[model samples]
Target: MDIEAEKARKFRISDFDLIRLLGTGARSSIWEGRDTSTGKSFAIKRTFKQPEDDNRYLDQAINEYEIASRLQHPTIRKVFSLKRVRRVFSIREIHTVMELCLGKTLEEAPPNSLLEKCVVLIEVAKAVHEMNSKGYVHADMKPDNIVVSEKGRVKIIDLGLSCPLGTVKQRIQGTPSYMAPEQLVCWPLDARTDVYNFGATMYWALTGELPPTVVPHQDNSISAHQKSAIPPHIVKPGIPLHLSYLVTDCIKIEPSGRLGGMDAVATRILVIIRELERDQEPTFRIRQRHGTGHGGSFLVSEYRSVAVSERLGPERHVIR
Candidate 1:
């Protein structure tokens, strides 16, 4: 009868009521749906095949469901199942049921404190590492895909671009500002690719500046080379040198030049957190010296800072 009712029926989710539209992308829309029997909420991502469309959107929805459903990490959004409505032999519509992240995306509502931002980044890094460990790469990692709950919990969403490790995509895939150089060159994508994306994200999150990538923002002409990202501490003075170097190292042009993997990224972020928690203004910078092993060694330089969270700003309660 109604549009929501029709969606529920068509998706074979008759026990759930489509409450409202949460977000939209491409030919897909995510709805906040509630289970009638249990009153539990979930995010329902539905995509339709339009007259002018091919099967790209449908394939992406299916890909998201298949990849995300296999991940059980708390920092990653959970996917339940895929539902398809077939018209004759052609599929007309598809739906993916996922965990409803009850807050705004990092792009929409970023945390105020640098420490809090690091916490969020650490969560995402760990989750990405988990995906890599499970033989997948989150080819797309950006602020818009990271949802932060009111209680400060973080959830990484949008697995549509994810692919098996060593996947060399047929076409360039990733947000321009955050796309790794390897992704631009159609090279074999491994955990290092995610490292670059994560680093670019961290760079922007901390300094509010986009890192240099092979693909410029929304430009058709691709750059043949990428310059080093300006260190975060240089862009923003108060940012700790430890973090600044880490961010710079992550966005290195060559995958071999960056950190070993996402696990290393999380470890370095944790070290920064621990140093900041100490609350002492220490004159030292921690630089990750590559080629040592999987875990890079840190070298010291002149730098000083207070606790990141308190120094940056007061932590305000996030209103969902």
Candidate 2:
């Protein structure tokens, strides 16, 4: 270990109290921590240095910190600090402090309504599009890596597999159900790769089923670049045709055939979100106020149009 980076600090694990283990990776384990001074919750990822023959786990952790530090978006999880710790003379570990996105992973907490699906996908698309603009492809995009907070904030949580655009992944790094065809074959990655992943993620969010990965068809005429997609509308009969079309087009096996760019994909999804918002019928709220409408004093119940989709007290509800 350098003991000193060009700019950053070296600290010990004793600085924070570990609350619970969040998750584990090949070379790193994330723990929910509480800062000693601030007492605020944070997710700390402790990455153990791996030997050369073992995957570059330390480097990947640094890469995640670098990539996450550069991109700043509400839906994109943030890394607050990075520290290096030396447990022994020759052993070093990297600790990444991040915002504690409290909630169940999207894989664990499936969305219940179409509106919820639309809201989640729109935020994810915006964040991914931003990363694409900066030339990074989140090689892994899946429900397991997304946290839908108890307060309803959707955050993209992991970046271990993230790599720069135009970079060809040497190994398969993404989940099978959401992996783009090019990624599996080690093709150069770009914005379209994110589009495919986003499409697959949204497909699962809308329908309870996952998209079939691209595979070589039995006949020689069909190439491995062809994917067998079951439209969301097909699985979930209530899925709108427009959304069904959007999800199918997003997962096109070939890069050229899929939505050309994630920015465009995001825009198209935004349009759908707006349309969905408009389709929601306005709801009225009844407010009680003291007034004298007649000769006698009485309480007046006034009805005013409040809004739709937002929660209303304990009787929280969202339109499907």
Model 1 clash pairs are 284-303, 285-301
Residue lDDT tens for model 1, 1-320:
24554456544356679877665676777788998989999988888888788888898888888898888888889988788989989998997888987666778656566765776787788789889999999989999899766444678988999999999888887788998877876779999999988988898889788986565435433353556667889889999888999998898886888998988888788788776657743443334333322123222122333332322222321212
Best by lDDT: 1
User: lDDT tens string, model 2, 1-320?
Assistant: 33223113332366798776655666667777889998998888888864563536777888899999998877889998887666666446788999888666778766555655676776677778788888899878888888766555679998877889999877766788898878777778988988888888888888878898765334423264454687888898988899999988888877888888776776676667667656764442223222321223232232222232321111222211
Candidate 1 clash figure, as a count: 2
Alpha-carbon runs more than 4 Å astray in model 1: 1-13, 215-225, 280-320
> Each model's TM-score, in the order given?
0.81, 0.78
Residue 102: error of model 2 in Å?
0.6
